[model samples]
Target: MNNFTIYLATLLCLLASKVVGQETFETRAKNIAAKIETITKEEKSALKEEVEAVNNQLEKGSITLEQAENKKKVLAEARAINIEARVGKEQENLKNLVQEKVDGKISESDTIKKSNQLILKWEKGDKKHIAKNEKRTTSQFVFAAGLNNLVTDGKIEDSDFRFLGSHFYELGLTYNSRLAQNSNFLHAKYGLSLMYNNLRPTDNQNFVINGEQTNLETNPIHLKDSRFRNVYLVAPVHLEFDFSGSETKGNKRYFKTHQNVRLGIGGYAGFHLKSKQVLKFDDSNLEATEKSKGDFNTSTFIYGLSSYIGYKETSLYVKYDLNSLFKNNTINQNNISVGIRFDLN
Candidate 1:
């Protein structure tokens, strides 16, 4: 048989040995006392194995004799403490079991039920123990992707960029801090993010840099694809209102967020990292691709207004750049995006 099967058989046999019919209070108390003895024996046996391993390391010159002695001392003390704690816990259980038996709160059949429960606990690992103190600030990963376009002189309809083809994406980390000690209604959310914005012209047009202006003009070749992209590293902050409420536990209150409806109004400011343009077309019946990286008179610093509204981790998001897309254009244009945002805690 495999080791797991053998281990399970041993547990079953140990439990079977404890099974009894119509046990008196004294008998149950004796069983718990026997378990305390077993705990001590198990811890001592484990200590013996650890000491043997330490001795083997010393013999192999992997550890000095003094080191081995120190390790043995620590292991012995740890095992002794473990035995005392385990036995003390069992003794308390014994006291409770006996008291409950006398008070008629526990029946004879409960002994078997308790034994089964112990076996189940042995099969499955113990549940994790959580601390009482909770942190006030938590972090989450932010990701957003959606359609990107440009608004010219505060008009989206007059924009030259194609609405369907343009796109924007943002990836970052954000921290949410509760503004009030006992309320979950408000939070200050802030983070650093990288933003990517791409704009594709409506016609077969590509950006041309004039002496002092960046303008769109028809490509000489039949353009298969033409795109202008800008990358920015920005720090965003928001005042987020969460309607998730709070829960009380043992004289302390814990505020919860991103569990219900949430609204965030924020803005970001950052410097432009890069701007590039890409063009692909047929050159003399052969497919050709061209890439150009330059400032293209685009703004050096970028700041934008952004907001989101939705339930839980996901929300409908929108952002609009306040600065002009290009510095010296005849009519100023600003980048804008609309999409879905996800905050993964």
Candidate 2:
């Protein structure tokens, strides 16, 4: 309760604070040391114990063989990875501390040398860089060319040229690739086929007499006498796949062999040029002007599904036109064809 007692109490309080502060720093330093030791030993020991647990469960029939194997592998890898990351962070912190203290009193001349060496080490330490050096691109483009066939048959109005033949020379382009988790690259390709037909179409009356359906060849007639010489075009789009294997496999890792089956579904659109029609029996020798349904029914924009599969340099392709070939009341045609393709990419 006196001034001397108060002064003595204040001095003791200040001395106690100084002693506590030093002990607190010492406690923090001990904690850091303990953390480092645990990371270096105890954590790894615990992970190993977890792995042993999985192995024990495996031996006891509590887990399937595959499950045990997966568990062991995943556990080991994850533990290693997590521990490595923690170790890396600690190492980085240590390096930063060392660098600060070492550079604090060192001459500036050694800065560039140390910095360059550190960068070199970092680059070499990167796992991604190592993986990238050995990994390949997982995508590719395809090109194909082949003989194409076009066959669409339907009844003509009031006449009989019931059958006609049309053919096309084909050209194609494709782009394909794979995503992670799946080996096969999803593919898309398109083709253009130009056809030239030299056959003429005729329609005649078939009279049923005496309970017999007979072609009245005796009286021949022509309703629309049309000949298409060089005027049919086809364009097809498809999405397909190569099922042989993933890029992490035999040829994809070696000779880059594209040996697999690829099937696609898409649509096709086209145009018909140079159409002709003859309208009379006596006009058999007469060639009437071809009226290209160019008005409203001329061009066919058919979009249907297509697919294919093949291997190596050869692949199969199928295309169907969903859109009607003709705008007329008559179902002129939706196309279908199967053919081989060649890869150019």
The 10 consecutive residues of candidate 1 with the worst lDDT sum are 125-134
Per model, state how many residue pairs clash. 0, 18
Relative to the true structure, how large is the alpha-carbon lDDT of every model?
Answer: 0.75, 0.43
| Candidate 1 ranges beyond 4 A from true positions | 1-133, 283-286
**In candidate 1, what are the lDDT values of residues 1-345, reduced to their tens digit?**
432233233223333333453234435544664565466457757967998999999999999988986687567546645754775576466556544644778566766666666557645643321121255688765668789998888889966788888998875668899888777788999976768899999678999999889999998788888999988767899999999998765555557778899999999997665688999996677688899987788886899899999988779999999999898888989999999887755
Ten contiguous residues minimizing lDDT sum, candidate 2: 206-215
**Per-residue lDDT of 138 in model 1:** 80
Q: By lDDT, who's the top model here?
A: 1
Instruction: Compose the digit string of candidate 2's lDDT tens values, residues 1-345.
Output: 432233233223222322322333223323433444456355457766997899899889999989986676566446545654674554454344334433554333454455555458655665553444234332222323233233345332333333323222333233343433333455445544333323333344322122222122322435343333233444565555556553343222422325655565666555443333222333657544433221123333335565656765456765554554444524354434455544433
Q: Candidate 2 at 329: error in angstroms?
A: 2.3
Candidate 1: how many backbone clashes? 0
